[model samples]
Target: MSTFGEINEPSSRTAWEDWDDIFVTDDFLNLRLEKDVDIPKEIDTFIILEGRYLYDCVRAHHNLELVNSNAEVNLCLFKTKELNNYVCMIRDYNLILSSEIVELLKKYITISKDVIAIVTKPIVEYQVSELVSKDYVIRSISSSKQSTSNLDIHFPNLEQPNIISGVSAGVLCWREIIDKPAVAIICYMEHPEEQQIQELYELLERFKIIPDIAKFHRDNLFNSNLYI
Candidate 1:
């Protein structure tokens, strides 16, 4: 597995000096697909959830069928029954993907519209009063390299000093390089709070990407005595 920095060479050092690097070695990621998983030839939206909390929250609410899996990752699909809008979910535990895997993933999905990636950042990292008051704040950065009309309506653009790394960053960088459309939604929160999870659900629902389901299974998982 090759690192992103190695595979995609930057045109100039000064331009990418602030960008974070992805170091992918065999030791860090051992991806092995047990079975051949068929991905849809075309996709309306491809959603990637990085953190464990977000993955569990979405898995709890959506009846996602496992398409592929291994030790580090779980690939699932959520298709709307009526509209037939395909939403592919990649629950990446380690938040790293090789360039070959990234290309292979993009080759099949062939997202016609948008690629949405949701990742989390610690609230302590930022000093914004809005995050302190709201308990969580969702900001976005798009591949367009310019303000997106639709996304700007919902969440503000992610500012400087905050960089995206790992799988989400790799995908976004690839899309930007190819001039395709992709957006990374960064959620800044202290912990896995119900309010924050619900806000995420609402955001996905607004895009008509996820299904409506019963309560999240966070209570059972988070409050369980097994961890204590």
Candidate 2:
């Protein structure tokens, strides 16, 4: 388990920053069985979904077709706000993750149907220990100190170590707009192959973990003004 840097102020920007395990099916078994083998050499690549992409995906969960005309008012109210605030508010409920995200969304579906209850992972350390038990590593590179005045993109050198059989989606959290982004935990698969890779991503998508992946990207870059 690894730590994402220090947490900051307790604002409405409550980060589900604890780095809980991004839910995966039990099919994502442990890595101890093949810990001794050499990792495979495939081109390491990643799929990038922008913030809007995930926002749209979550919004898609709000199905208006089946609801009766009376419930339409609640749906209308739910549609008026920005996705980020809505998501932040939804996070405050402290709902259980025992089911799939889609299923959870269905259960706790309405924003207010008037006022939605706003609410506000893993240890590769304390954050994710219960979620992930597999072994993995964090790969990073620190560059020369750059000007803090411009909050531009800071790309990673991407000189990552070999991809293993099991690797969970990158988890990202921000205590505030000003802090640096960090990895939550890393997991490995016992054997890496095209099918397994596809399956891993499919499971993540099915469980709706893609938003956390996008959050990692969103938190890592700064605006031209150095704002998060």
Candidate 3:
């Protein structure tokens, strides 16, 4: 299994690369898991797991018992190195969690005493908007057509500042409302933090989901389809 690269179609390859960077980074781990636990499963999967990481692109291993694939959670974070009793972990760090993603995760994740989850996407995504929209991205090394086992997220060929202003565009836009503690998940899917953050703040201000992202990590952020 080959990791996404500068093949004939670099756009797609680049998109995955951006996702790869975000998915495997320490900061991303915090944003997705909303915890301080250092996910020690990967350190350059490209170098450590190599072939196995590439195989992950298929993303066919949907069963939590099979591998680290789950549908129910928005999967801002995960860890799966072992198999056949493989421990596929999930954490919903978004301000307002996604119901679909949660349902999907539950479908495949093999439950045991160790299985765990936390937070809500609807609550999280809605709260962390200091600007109109910020990109929320993810990618896998598997060859499977489906990125995740469910509507985890979609790869859009749109421009930057893409539009994280959808359903989770802050609590005001959300249909069903819940006032859970707003969780801020940092996304480096853009650039020029000051500028990007300004735009995002404006967007959220309108909706009143202005984020309190006083502190965050910024490294390996990417442009939109320009890289894709």
Instruction: Identify the candidate with maximal TM-score.
Output: 1
How many collisions per candidate? 0, 22, 36
- The root-mean-square deviation over C-alpha atoms between each candidate and the true structure, in angstroms, is 8.7, 23.4, 20.0
Relative to the true structure, how large is the alpha-carbon lDDT of every model?
0.62, 0.24, 0.27
Which regions of candidate 1 deviate over 4 angstroms? 1-32, 74-92, 95-101, 109-111, 127-131, 145-153, 193-195, 207-210, 213-228
> What lDDT tens digits, residue by residue, belong to model 3 across residues 1-228?
776785465554535555455445454221223344432332211111111121232133332222233333433233333321222223323434443333333322312112111111221333323553534332111121222123122222223343333112331122113221111122333322222343333322222222233422222224223353
lDDT of 2 by residue, 93-200 (tens): 112321222232221222211111100011122232235344322232222322233312233232334321111111121111223222211223332211122322
TM-score per candidate: 0.67, 0.16, 0.18
Question: For residues 1-228, could you state the per-residue lDDT of candidate 1 as single tens digits?
Answer: 767666565667465543468665667454555567665666666666677666656665544445554444565545644443555455554444645456546654355456778887787775553435766777888877543435433578887777778777888887798788788889888766444456677666655545653433454444456774
For model 2, the superposed segments whose C-alpha errors exceed 4 Å read 1-50, 62-157, 160-228
Model 3 scores a TM of: 0.18
Instruction: Sort all candidates by lDDT, best to worst.
Output: 1, 3, 2
Q: For model 1, what is the alpha-carbon lDDT of residue 224? A: 59
Which residue pairs overlap in candidate 1's backbone?
none
